[model samples]
Target: MRPFLASCLGAACTAALALPPAPAAARPADPSGPVAGPEASRASDLPGGTQSLPLEHLVPAAPGAPAQDMAAPQGGAVHELAPRTVRPFSLVGIVWDDVAVALRGRVQIRTRGRADGRWSGWQDLQNEKSDDAPDPGAAEGLGSAAHGSTAPLWVGASDAVQVRLTLADPHRAALAVPHGLRLELVDPGPDTPAARTAPATTPEATASSAANAPLAPLGATEIPAADQAAAQADVTAAGGAAPAAPVHIGARPRIVTRAGWGADEKLREARFVYTRNVRAVFVHHSATGNNYTCAETPSVIRGLYRYHVKSSHWRDIGYNFLIDKCGSIYEGRAGGVAKPVLGAHTLGFNNDSTGIALLGSFGKTAPPRAALEALGRLTAWKLGLHGADPRGRTAMTSTGGNLYRKGRVVEQHVISGHRDGFKTECPGTLLYADLPSVRQAAARLQGR
Candidate 1:
């Protein structure tokens, strides 16, 4: 009740807020465009190759990165869904300066397809995981006028998705749970018995809550205190922000592995996982860095049976989560996810690929910039939860830098570097030439 900070592994990790409070504002824009219950059809509707990204072209850092100086953003609008249904996604998280915080979870999206059709890959999409957003709403105050909320996460579809939010352990180090998280795609609206109890709050609801990011609560530096009935049932969860951070998954979840083809070769490759729902996101780079984080790190099934039954026979331990230069993000496939699953660590490309391994060797070195700006704001909050489209396309053919040739479609291709979609290099060339400064420092942290 007074800017807390210290709990265990339930959530709200670094708790702190409680200053003067009440003086920030900026929680109004769901004019049905950020993503929620159907409607969204615009963007001309898409079909002839479909390509349009602009959350300010999802930038965060890619040119001399430092988050490219910070400040100068205001571009986020997506609405184009109806690719034939099949959902189980979310990437919601919130965090401002003083109040309003929520971090509903669920982000283990790893579904892949293409095998009898042409040998596909990637799997592990069991129940995904969600159930805790009970109140999560409140903010509008905290230094620099703290007012920034958008941690959305829906996971169904959005032009090749890729999201990673691994921060387990007393909020990982300097503490920062949801400095604002967004990832859209809900649209369940109807009442249906209060949508089966309530939690998706607004922006549409259906399919319980999930974790991995979009966390905004507290009491975890060692246990700050407050179980007042699970923070009063999360105060109607899934909607709130305006504090700093609180992702209390503190030490005790560090065993994650993924290499796949097992389970009897995934039932002989279940006829290519999805068939036609994946679009683009093949980034890679586990170029070997070793492994291990803090807050305990050990839950992806004991880190994938110690990398496939004690280090190599080729089983688990590829890249679904690894980041450790000290920015913390350790959880690699014993599950793997981000919806519509399938990931092995890039080849013909893990069907969709949401892998993230960064232990070291960036072709020699260059890895930590606050752990690449916290993995480029956790990959721009999972490409704003799959509505992916942060604009980035410019090449009239006149001497260049990124090359840009293959098909050429822009609107949602961000914070990439694993040699920008396979060729072997892996996050090399000093981290794939610093993916345009970490995708423009995570699209200026959501102003793209």
Candidate 2:
């Protein structure tokens, strides 16, 4: 029975593991720049019911005054009622064209609803926080750092919108506004109730459950390779003691897929599936605020989804899975949760691994115990599938980065924090300090 199972599953798994990781140059450049004043610079009909509206129609350089300095005007600037026809957009984000220019100010957005002509209250969009790690595929002279606009804010369903930017220091007004401001409108796909139900089982979590039997206990006696021939002969002659129930290393936990959180499927571009053997799990904190309740998680996810896709212009969410402070896990990126879907979370080493980001920033505060436990359960389940030891050290080849030069081999914990691979304070100082405990808990779950 052991030989039969091995023959059935080994080949596929071997091929997957032997495959080489893709080069860093393969990642696409982030789309930046938005037209601050209406007139829409260029209207692009994008995939997934998303539209890109560039600020082509800028406040025309005052009747030909050499393009009005492209730099942001001094003091507070308000663009009331964007100069575009109202459309049915459920999500919105700000984008820019330059990578070097950093905007410093408070950005507030308010949208007009079609139903009652009422405008939504001003919503604060988070400014772009410094990510110590450089972006993958950064061009010459462009450091690995991620340079873009602030994270998006959820505005529910709306037609019209307005935005205001107030510079913190008027002295910095000399800095240009980058190329322009772009507003992305995303249409949440069909609201089909039937398609929104929670999945009873996911690929990884259900692997053991669906078999309807406890796995063979670990440490079961193993026959030497030289004795396998005789063992197989015996198994063929007599159905060999029904392969002592396969070892059950760890149990999978309940997870919420992007769909489970009512994600707008149309916001992200078509799924980009890249397969790799799960060698390590990198932990990270979303670096967003923590003043949210469990009920508002879905809303928070929507905002993040829009930001990652529309604003950052990535293929999908940077993390493979997101865990809220309440311990709820939500699937990220548009691929099978069980697969080693490469993420953009860790700049230099995103291949052959998985990224799990806690939903809130933990720079000063420690992560909740519940969140830590969920992290353990998740890594235990994910890594166990690939026969990886969570507490062990492993080596991964860096695709490239500022922290570790391209093609260099780097060692990491089976369960590590984002800072382990890059020079960033990601995963936060407090949360990163807790990784040792996380590794221990995961190993315990794996019965290591």
Candidate 3:
């Protein structure tokens, strides 16, 4: 039998580490002029903010002409904006007032690069309503703020944009566009000097630092790895109770804390939610595109956070953790990294699972070897914490989704792709194809 380590209270574990506090002013607040409203104030406090503009209907094309023939759409009920300049932004998405309504059509966008001053070809924004979301009726899923949205696309640094939305079947009266449609342009903000040079000392940063404990010093950017024996001993030292059955646990791997990437604590809802245990790990790719340098990763992550909370009205960021193309892992959400924090990631399956999103679109491009290795190490350690076998399968109850109905228990891989639980192409095709190897590697890391 695989040896198992006991679990402990997050506070107790953190106290046991007892590291020194970090510098108080590691990340200074934004210096931009103040804005209006609670939401706008929150945005101004962060390094970057979002710009929302309503989409307008365009006149129909000439009779019997193809929709593609005109500069814009040539047919029925099209909503779009002609090319226009806007403030600097690195990410973009479309959102509507109602969460229940789905966009039954194609959504495309083109942008002018901020640096090069060149316009890029139009790209499709995946309709993410059916896949990426909190479970139905959950607190995050309910409310005036929660809205239907397209998958966010990372457009790099762009100063101008154009958007087009069209129904799949223009002639069908039943297929109409959703109401309150608007475009959200998100600027992740520039990497601040303090964030890049100093250690974080905020309460949230301290909590995150404490979660990693002895594996990483307080305010350290990355947690260092430990051997299996040392890792188990560290858990025991942290007062983890002994488990009844033997459980296999893997060596802990290095992980970047939220503070490491400079997350503004004031942005997300203060309260943290917990689950019973983590039974599975759902993998995803931030459909945000791959046009980024490793140095720009922190800004990209910050942009995603703002988009999720400020734009989509989620209580917090969706994924439990985010991995960069270079394989550096950043803690996602606000709860302790080791705890079973409920995240608004995979629809219908957020109950007993953890979500890990890779930081770029992967439909055609393959994830780097370092990223895949990091995935293996992270899964092995995290799943091992809960006695879950990385290569084994687990049955998770679905709340409600395109693939499974509410209350249905579905058996799935302990490590699964986003598409496995929903009817959408997430984590992309190429990355999805690599899960088997990742599973195998994780299992080996556990000494199984």
The candidate that wins on TM-score is 3
lDDT by residue (343-433, candidate 2, tens digit) is 7777777888888989777877889999999898888777766667989989999866557888889889989898888777778889999
lDDT for model 2 comes to 0.57
TM-score of 1: 0.21
Clashes of 2: 20
For every model shown, the clashing-pair count is 119, 20, 3
C-alpha positional error of residue 433 in candidate 1 after TM-score superposition, expressed in Å:
6.6
Q: What digit string (tens of lDDT, one per residue) describes model 3 on residues 1-448?
A: 0010012112334322122221222111220111111111224655678988665422222234333433344443444454556777889998877777877777788787878777777788888674578888777732445778888888888877766666545433133456677789998766876854243556755665676655667777666777776656443323356555545777887777777787776667766788888899999998888888888888888888888887788978899999988888888987777778899889999998999999888999999888899899889888887778999999999999989999999998999999999988998999999999999999999889
Q: Which rank order by lDDT, best down to worst?
A: 3, 2, 1
* Poorest lDDT segment (10 consecutive residues) of candidate 3: 1-10
At residue 255, candidate 2 shows an lDDT of 66
Q: Could you estimate the TM-score for every candidate? A: 0.21, 0.59, 0.82
Tens-place lDDT digits, model 1, residues 150-222: 2122222222222222233323312433332322322212223232233223221111112212222111111
